[model samples]
Target chain A: MILINGQPENRIPVSDRGLQYGDGLFETLAFRNGELELLEQHIMRLQRGCKRINLSFQHVDSLRAELAMLCAQTAEDSVIKIILTRGSGGRGYKAPLENEAIRIISSHSMPEYPEANQSGVTVRLCEQRLGLNPTLAGLKHLNRLEQVLARSEWDDRTISEGLMLNINENLIEGTMSNLFIVKNQQLLTPALTQAGIAGIMRSKVMEIADSMSIACHEKALTVNDLLDADEVFLTNSIIKLWPVKTLLHNDTNTHWQHGALTQQIQNALKDLAH
Target chain B: MILINGQPENRIPVSDRGLQYGDGLFETLAFRNGELELLEQHIMRLQRGCKRINLSFQHVDSLRAELAMLCAQTAEDSVIKIILTRGSGGRGYKAPLENEAIRIISSHSMPEYPEANQSGVTVRLCEQRLGLNPTLAGLKHLNRLEQVLARSEWDDRTISEGLMLNINENLIEGTMSNLFIVKNQQLLTPALTQAGIAGIMRSKVMEIADSMSIACHEKALTVNDLLDADEVFLTNSIIKLWPVKTLLHNDTNTHWQHGALTQQIQNALKDLAH
Candidate 1:
């Protein structure tokens, strides 16, 4: 069974560009407590990401409604994915000259966070560095081969996640999540102005940091910065916040355990589930 | 009408990781006068690409038949695309512990290359450089937001394409097509061991050059090589060969122009297309 546009259906034109060039945006949000985890934030990111790609924003509200309806069906915790593509035509990169309705695809699946949250994951730095494209950075658009490749780097059950850097060898985010490092009690993440997605979870953490008076800054972070930091952790809507028990800095055999700050942030993020 | 194992279908499951994580491989081929243009070469590249991503090859034969059927449906000349995504369910990047099926999606559309072929195109070198991930570099995997941003750089109809480079400053390929530079008398393209797709059109050009006893070398390319080149051109199956009338070298006032070598390679590539 499928829910396409608030109705049960099974057909979308094969020419939809999302199926073509992945010319679209997607939000993989958590659905719990009978509500979308961050519906508005996902919508805003979808809108912002659409503008970044020059895709028309028509029918977005209807699509959002469709997503809400689909998520409402499960009644239990699930991972809801919302995909909005330029809806098929106008040849390659050109958005259809006429206004094209964005195709909406909302799917639900059992959430996979409880296990990771129970036992902090062993994270490693991936060799595949995210490119510093300030323009396309921060939005979780459809182009995800890099994440797939980075995630494919290891199948070892022990390694939970991988960190990615930009071309300048600056630590960025993970294959799927955003990265945060605490150095001298200051919260820092690699500036998304160059690369990396400004994930909703990362944004939430920044807001929380401000509320608590923690100095949070977005700046360039290198392997050295992360290696020498007081603490390191990763965040995504699904993962919430994960304290890194291990880090594979590109240079040496040096590794560190989850620091006090990682614990603090992880605790704060966990409370949001309640 | 459609064909997947010779049956019409559209759905590939909501949990299909390819749709979820862009975890799949794809090929866009031109079908002219009833022939699956570059059939063997395209399939070989797809096979090599699939292997790199670790997707199963079991359904490849039936998938090939499906493509042939899809292409046959296009009585008139058209562009054909076949996407082979690792079908469904896996937690994060780890491939599902259980065996997985491959989802094959094929679609057809008319070629959109007339304007580009008639009047040569002006291209801007995109600020969004392609990420250099050796693991996913040469494969035409689903993660393609980089190209989307590069292609979105221009809205003017006259500017046909954009040139992309790796973060290390090595010239990669056009947002959609592979690039070729003719300097003095040799043919050159940036090697794709680290970035860019090894386009079937590129392979054909190399064959044509060898047959004509023209030296075609794949090596590292830089802005300096392009700025000093005698002729510059871009190629893909759709736009057979497009000469670079002018190229925007970043934000600089510098531009590349049409040249003799560009014309020769254009004609040479056209000859091989028949």
Candidate 2:
């Protein structure tokens, strides 16, 4: 099902700035058993994104009401996507002085991943490096061509995700998820000050780790550092966590066995879900 | 007027990857007196963009036929825009194994610029810097949030355009046009290896210079070099040439009296248009 500005429609004007210039922001969230998981966090991030891009978002209360109603109507697990565009405009990049925002909310069935993904998945490094822009970093805005291009780099079903590096050759993130590596019983994830989206699940996982008294660090990471880690995993709104078993680069590959830390984090995530 | 896949429609499916991830490319061209100016160059650049990003463009002949018909129907000057998207798909970054491309073509009336713009226009330096990515650079892809953001930086009516620099602080291009500076009777534009779109008009100006026996260079340029130049101008498909009368940067304003070279080039462009 889809809704354009609270009405049932699956089409937007071609002149929409979202379609024309990718001038928009979006959030994907999961709902389970008549409740949205991490809805507040998603809303907070969306509001932050709107503020960063200077897009006025004044209908937050009504938007929440619509989302809650949509969640209540869903009978099973589903993923809900919310898109806010700068609305339709005449030609050129200069926006209209009085442009109204467009809101699109849609729902989709939950994806069924292979059982192996729950245990551990294989991954590879992508050749396309993300462009570094501090102004746009850490926000889940609609300008995501780099991720789309990186995801299209491979079609092998065995490989689950591809890791992306920044222009400076520092590890940034996965195509659709945030990356975390465990070394010497410490958790470290790449700092997204220059590039990459800061996933909501990543923050939740860090909170879980804190409750368990685990040390977590957000710092610059390199491919070699990721390869040398004892354990690795990925996180996103849909797939809360996925242990990574192999890392492939060109003709060479590095293998790893799922460690205690990975199992413990998975257990904590599951327990928190209930 | 608008056409989607040769059919008249102004709306596209919300599921389009172009709206979702900006997985697309676009071109804006001008048509005058029942003829599309630089149509072949636009087609060439569109093809190059699709090839660079691995989007199959098999219907180039048919696309040309449609464009010619659209241009022939125009009674006066007009601006036509062509967009190619990866089509609609299920949720996620992974494109469907077999994706059908979507083509959107639209037309609008030509904009009326002030007579002063022909003599010279004033511009300001934008504080926002472009991100560096070689793979995506030089291609007029749909990931244009940076341009939109830079354009929104100011709302001054007198400033025709804003100049942007890359992360390395080297001058790249204007928000909607390419930049060229003249020094010692020689022309130099920024090298776009690291960032910036390689504008078709920029290439044409260089060709015009070559025919007129003028020196043209594509090299790294700085803001100081731009302010110190004897003359500067901006170019795009529309607004063939606009001389730089004044450049505003911080507290330092550089004023220039329109030079002979600018007039010579403008006359050359007008003659070629005939």
lDDT tens per residue, model 1, B121-162: 777788778766666678888777677667766777666788
Tell me the RMSD of model 2 versus the true structure. Answer: 1.6
lDDT per residue for candidate 2 within B27-50, as digits (tens), equals: 988887566778889889999998
Off by over 4 Å in 2: A271-274, B271-274
- Chain B, TM-score, each prediction? 0.90, 0.96
Model 1 stretches astray by more than 4 angstroms: A58-60, A98-119, A246-260, A270-274, B97-109, B112-129, B153-160, B165-170, B220-224, B243-274
Expressed as tens digits, the lDDT of each residue in A1-274 for candidate 2 is 8878778789999999999999999998888666688888988998999888878788888788778777767889999999998998744888766665678898899888897898899999998899999889999989898998899899898999999999899999999999999999999999999999999999998998999999999999999899899999999988889999999887888987788998899888773332
Q: lDDT of model 2 at residue A174? A: 99
Question: In angstroms, how far off is A99's CA in candidate 2?
Answer: 3.2
Name every residue pair that clashes in candidate 1. Answer: A138-A196, A138-A197, A138-A198, A144-B143, A145-B143
